[model samples]
Structure formats: structure tokens, C-alpha cells
Target: MKLGIFLLAAQFEAGDQGTVLTSAMDAGCAAEEAGFDEAWIAEHHFVPYGLCPSAVTFAAMLLGRTDRLRVGTAISVLPNTHPVALGEQAALLDQLSGGRFTLGIGRGGPWVDLEVFGSGIERYDEEGWAESVDLLMRWLTLRRVGAEGKHFRFRPVPVVPRPLTRPHPPAIIACTSATSAALAARQGLPMLLGMHADDCEKAEMISAYDAAARACGRDPRGVEHAAASVALVADSRAEAVRELKAALPRWLNRGLSAHQTVDGRARTMRDPHAYTDYLCEIHPVGTPRDVIAALRRTTEATGIRRHLLFAEGAGRPERTLDNIHRLGKEVLPEIRADAEQ
Candidate 1:
């Protein structure tokens, strides 16, 4: 199985922004040294939930720092930026990284990002988001493209710095819902499924994605799907779970607090106990042996080949490096061996 680290660059303590950013880059270097294949970074705005506002810029920095580790956006919020600009940036990054860039796009949630970026919530709706994705693909693939849509209008214009990766850097969709899964399938793109989904939900979603892809005249088996989950492989299962349990609440609560209704209702953030229960139910946190078992079960159920390990969340830099080390030294080889067998 392909293994990668997901860096959220979240700030949990009162520290200099430079320190947090440095730690994130350091984590990417560590992941590379530890034999990880890729490192994906998240984009957020006006919140400490995620410090990276421009994933493309951050990806450039990491690409320059690492020699072989592929760098990508966990997601570049589509509605928040222009498709043309994004395509140009991604193409340049792919060239600079020697074809080691993956462009993951998503219709972000109804959050402060939209308000802060002045991208109205309407653009985040189904129709608008679909339009954005279409335009993005056009910009990436076509030499000269024009589009007339409710969300975007452009006369025929040339897109320079075409991506080095044949058609374009692998463009994957971040699938959070069934609709998103269908969108990815229809576009013949892979998906990045989040950790919030349980095993049953993940399996169901993957099945739906496969069916949709087949309906679109694409081969489902050939498409690569990735699953993101918090993974911490420690010497003992008890230690791993304890560390994860201690850090997870902050990440969950912060996410919940960031997205809320106009009427000031924080639905998911209200219940800490339920959040903890849900976290334990979804994440794969334990010793190397236990994590491998859990991952194998997930792969069997969902046919996920790429496992995006989110071991850097909740702002624990030390723990993040340790998890990456243990994953490389103790877990990854076993997982690869099992796959080979």
C-alpha cells in the first residue's frame, strides 16, 4: 500500500507562526527521510484550525526542500480561488517537483473561509462547485479554453506552463458525500475519503464511487482511492491510544467550533463525550501490529490502496515525528510485505 502523511499545520499552543510553519516543513522532511511516499497539506483561512491559506505556495516550499517525496494539497478549496490561477500554479509546481505533485480539489464546507475569501456560499453549492471543477480540469488539460457558466466566464485564453505529468498532475477529488463521490467518478478522478467516516460508510461510499465510475464508462478497478485516518504507531497499543485520545478532542472540538449555523448553533461541538466516542470509533491508533490489522481490514473492505496518515494534527510536533518514524521503521514494511504476499 502507498503511505503518506497529511499535515494540517494547525496551531494548538501560543507560539510564533514561524515556529508552526517551520515545524510543518520539518515534518515533511522527516516523512521523506522516514520513507513516506507523499506529504499532503491542508488549506484554511482566518483560523488556527489550519494555518495554510495557500496550499500551492506551501507545496512549492516543500517541493524545493525534498528530493523525492511527492507533495500535494489535502485540498485546495475550489470556490475560494480562480481555476485558471490554480491550474497555472499546479502546473508550475508539478514541473518544479519533477512530476511529483498531486492536485486535490474540493468544495469546502460552509465555513469562515468563504466569508473571509469573499466567495459567497452560493459558489459552494452543488451546481457552482461542479462548474468550478469543470473549469479547473479544462484549464489544466486544454491549451486554450473558454467557458460560459453561472460561476465563471472566460473568452478563449491560453494556459501556460502545462503540467509535466502528461495530461496533468493527478487531480483527485476530496469526497465527503455520496454526491462528491459521484462527481469524482464521473470525472474519472480518484478520491480522498476523510477519517470522519466509519468502516461501513467508507465501504458504501467506495462501492458507490465504483458503480458510478463504471456507469461513466470508466474502469472502477483501475481507479485509486485514498483513505485518511489518524494513525499513531507506538511501542505499545496503550501508549498510542492514550496519546491519540489526549490530542483528538482538541482537533475535533476546534473543527466543530469553526463551522456553525447563522443562528449561532454549534451542533457537533456541544458534546465532548460524543466527539471522543466518535474519534475512537474512526481513527486507527495503536501499536504497529494493531494499526496494521486495522488498515488491512479497511483495505479489504474499501479497496483503498493509498493510506493518508494524519499523524500531525492537534499541533503535537514531537508526537507527529515519532509517529512518522515508527510508521516507517515498524509499520510500513509489514504493510508492504503483507500486500506483496
Candidate 2:
């Protein structure tokens, strides 16, 4: 049961960007000290949703502070950036983390995000994402790889530095659909299940990932499945709820609102009416006991190996830090250490 702490460095308040970033840094340091396996930073743009336009840059900042924690972008939207350039950036980050970088990539979905990148709504479809990822994989491994399909072809120069970790670090996908899961399975990359509601959904997604992998003649052992359920752990369920009410709008609203605008499709979380209805059902936002019970239930249902907890607070870093310490000291030990089990 490997636990991860998820961080997103977004400008929540209008002022003090540096101060907010420092708080995020402090949170990462706290996560490392709390004995978690990783701290995943997310990527976003031109919005208060997430100020972290460059997640690898954020990784470099954490590498200097934490000893063992692997620094990763929860998922870098590959379609928006040239894979070749991002591959080089990831290589540098892999070295910076002392080979502790995990490469998590996804196709940007928030309609606005895709629009910004000049990719249309049709690009959000599975085929588009698959094409983008396939090209990315080829470019990262074989510099001159050429393709004549629906998407990409690049004149190749062998990308230098070539990543410090074998096969260019473990690859992960931020999963949204069965098609995406199938791609992850076929490619033997782990699925980072996003936008799920609870334990039942997670278990179902894990099964889906493994099934897709096995069906593709890929080893199930090579297909890692994990999910980040927004948890605000505290001493009591009441306090957890209070904290969640205050903090959760930042994560859920930001996440659910993010989908791609390809194929003439532009979407927005612009519908504020849906926020409350969506989060209440999906997010785990209570005490330690409530979180543990919810997580155990979800794990039992989903069979996920890794759990990433996305949580942080400005005025109460202590509470966030305390939650992680308790998670490391208590939550992980109770779960069977072997992921395969």
C-alpha cells in the first residue's frame, strides 16, 4: 500500500504568488518527512485552477528538499506540448530527482485548455489521445521514429540525455474512459484514474485496466493501477468535513471542469450549479476513521495498489502535515504491504 501526497501549486488568492508557492513547497517537504512514497504535482494554465504551468520545474524545487520521495506531474498534458521537447524536460527532471521521477502524461481535456493549444474538440476522443501518446512513446525511445497515421510525424534527432531511468521512467496515464484504460493496458503504462466517485468506481477501474492489459497480451504485472481520492483526514469526522468544505472546492471544481475542446466541442465547469452535486458524492472528506473506512472499502472494491491523497491548506499546514504523518504511521501499515495481494 504505497501512499502519495498530491500537490497543485495554483494561485488561489489574487496576490502573493510567491507566498502560495512557498506554502506548496512546505507541503511537499512535509509529505517527504511523513514517509510517503511520492508527491505528485499537477499541471494547469491561465486559470486560478492551477498556476503550475510547468510541473517538471516544480519537481526540481522539491528534489532539493526531499530525500526519497519521487516527484512527478500527476499528468502532463502531452498534446499541448511537443513530445520531443517535453521528453527532454522529463529527462532533466528524472536526473534532478536522482532517478526518482515518474512520467505521467495525459491529453488535455478542459475545452479551454485544448482551445488554448489550438487542438479542436475532436482531438479529445480516444483515437486522438492514443495517437499523441503513441508518437510520444516512439519519440522518447527512438528519436527518429516516423508515423503516417491520423496525428504526428517528426524529423528525428536522437534525443540526448535520454532519461536516467530505464525506458524513460515509469509511464502513467490520467485515465478518464475505457478507451484510455485500454491504451494504458496495451502500452503497459499504469492508469491514474481521475474523476471517479468512490471505492466501487476505483475497484471497477482497476479491474478495467488489468483486463484491458491482459486482453492486449500485456503482462498484468506490468500494468499498475492507482487512484487519487481527495481525502481530508483529521482527528474526527467533523473536523475533516469542516476542512474539506473549505478546501475541496479548489480540487474538485478544478478537476471536473477540466475537459478538452477538440472536435468543435468546447466545455466548461462554467456550470457552477453542478459543483456541489458532483463533489459530495465523489470526494472523501471526513475524519481519519471515515477516510480509512472509505479507502479500505474502495480498495476492497477496486484492488488498487497505490493511493494518492490530494490535500493541503494555507492557514493550516499543520493539520495537513498531521494528516499525512498519521497516514504514514497508521493508514499504510494496516494495509497489506504487497501491492499484488
Candidate 3:
């Protein structure tokens, strides 16, 4: 199994943007040092849930900071940005990083981010999202490309610095629903499952994706699917849970509540404490053995081999770094051993 870190850049403490950002960077460096395969950056706007507004930009920085580690956007919100421009950035990063970049895009929520970025609420719709992803794919793959879609109208342009990865650097779609899974399958790309869903739900989505791929005459057997899960390692399960319960809920409560819809659409926010409990139940936490078992169960259920572990559940950089180290030292070896079997 390939292991990676999910860098959310979540600001857990008030007025600590710089510290949080630095910690995120440190986490990426630590991930590489800890022998991780990749570090995926999260994109969020006007919220502390994730402070990085431009995942690609942040990814570029992380890529430069580490030589062997592959860097990617857990998702660069497609609705709020121009696909061609984003594609160009991805290609540039891929080339510079020696093909160590992965571009993961998603149809972000109907949040005020659309208004702030002047993308309009219409861009958040199904049609707009599909068009953008298609355009992006073309940009990454074709030498010269143009788009004449409902949301974009552009003349053919050269794809400069053409990605070092043939066809394009690896592209993943962050998907939660069956519709999005189908889209990813149709595009012949893999899905980046989130931590919010349990293993069974993830398995269902994978099934949906496989069905869609088969219907579209595409084989899904070789796709390297990835899933994000929370990780916090301690001497015991109770200690790990205690550490996460004390801080993660507060961060979730503040960050989730900060989201505002552009059209005043009702967005049901989860109860942070309850959600944390749910994550603890589904995700890998506690001792290395416990984490390995959790991850093994998830892998078996979802047929996933790549894992993006979110190790900042304690909302402290030191603790987060410790988790990364332990993950690489204790958990990764066992996971690889199990995979070999």
C-alpha cells in the first residue's frame, strides 16, 4: 500500500495563520522524511477548516521543499477557477517536479467562494463542472487545445511546459456521490474518497464507479484509487482518542460553521463532536496495530491501495509530526507486509 499525508492547513488556534501554514509546510517535509509516497494539499476559501486558498500554489511550494515526495492538491476546487489556467499550473509543477505532481479537482460546494472569485453560482452546477473537468483534461493531454463550452470559450493554445508525465501528470477526482464517481469513471480517472464516508459507503461508491466505467467501455482494474482517513497514534486507543477529542471538534465547529452559501441555500452543518466520534470509529487511530487493522479493513472493503492519512487531529504541530513519524515507522511496514500477503 502507498501511504501519503493529507495537508489541510487547518487553523486550530485563533490568530495563528502563519504558524498553522508553517506547520503544514513542516508536516509536508516531515511526511517526506518519514518516507511517505505523497502529500496532498487541501483548498479552502474564507474558512479556517482549510486555510490554503490555492492548492496548486501550496503544492508547488511543498514540491520544491521536498525532492523525493510527490505533491498534489487533495482538490483544487474546479468551480472557482479557470480550468486552462489551473491546467497550465499543474503542467508547470509536474515538469519542474520531475512528474511528481498529481492534480485532483472537485466540484466544490455552493459556498460564497463562487461569489468572491466571480465564478457565479451558475458555475457550481453539474453542467459547468463537467465542462470544466473536460476542458482541463484536454489542456493536460493535448499539445494545442481550445474550449467552446457553456462555461468557457477559448481559442486553441499551446500547452507549454507539457507535463513530464505522458498524457499528463496523474489526475484524480475528489468525489463523494455516485454522480461524481460516474464522472470520474467516464474520464478514466480514479476517485479520491474523503474521510467523511465510512468503508461501506466508500465501497458502494467504488461499485458505482466500476459500473459506470464498464458502461462507458473503460476498464477500471488498473486505477489507483485513494481514500483519506484520519490518523492519530498514541500509546493507547484511549489516549489517542482523548487527544483528538479535545481539539479536532473545536476546529471542526469553527471551520464548518464559517461556510456561507452564495444563494443562501441551506447547508446542513454536522455536529462537530458527533462527527469526530464517527471519524474515530471509521478511521485509523490509536496504536500502530489499531491503525493497521483499520486501514486493512478499509482497503479490503474499498479495494483501495493508496491512503492519504490526515494526521493533524490533535490540532498541534508537534503531535501531528509525531503521528507522521509513527505512521511511517510502525504502520507502513505492516501495511506493506499485509499487502504482500
Best by TM-score: 3
What is the TM-score (0 to 1) of candidate 3?
0.98
The reply for model 1, stretches above 4 Å from the true place, is 260-270, 313-315
Clashing pairs counted in every model: 0, 16, 0
Assess the local accuracy of residue 228 in candidate 2 as a C-alpha lDDT between 0 and 100: 79
Ranking by TM-score: 3, 1, 2
Report the lDDT tens digits of candidate 1 across residue range 1-341. 88899988877765687788888889989999999899999887766777888888898999999999999898899988888888889989888778989998988777756676677777788998988898899888888889899988878988788888877678899998889999998888998998778778888898899888888888888788888887877777677767766776676566556664323434544465576567555667777878888888888887887999887743578877887898899888987887698
Candidate 2 lDDT over 1-341, as tens digits, reads 67788877655445777776777788888888877888988887665666688777788888878888887788787767766677778777776667888878987664566667776544556777777787767656664565677766545466676767776566788887677778888878888977444666666666787788778787777355778766666677666666655655654565445543434444545343355335434655565556667667666677675777877632255666676677767665555454546
- Look at candidate 2 and tell me the lDDT of residue 196: 46
The TM-score measured for candidate 2 stands at 0.85
Off by over 4 Å in 2: 10-12, 119-123, 147-149, 250-284, 313-318, 335-341
- Name the weakest run of 10 consecutive residues (lDDT summed) in model 1: 260-269
lDDT tens readout by residue for model 3, 1-341: 88999989999989869889999999999999998889999999999999999999999999889989989899999999898889999999988889999999998799999999999888888888898899999889989998788889978888886888987789999999999999999999999999998989999999999999999999989799999999998999999999989998999999989999999988888899999899999999899999999998988888999999998889988988999999999998888787698
RMSD in Å for candidate 3, one decimal? Answer: 0.9
lDDT of each: 0.82, 0.69, 0.92
**How many clashing pairs in candidate 2?**
16
In model 1, what are the clashing residue pairs, if there are any? none
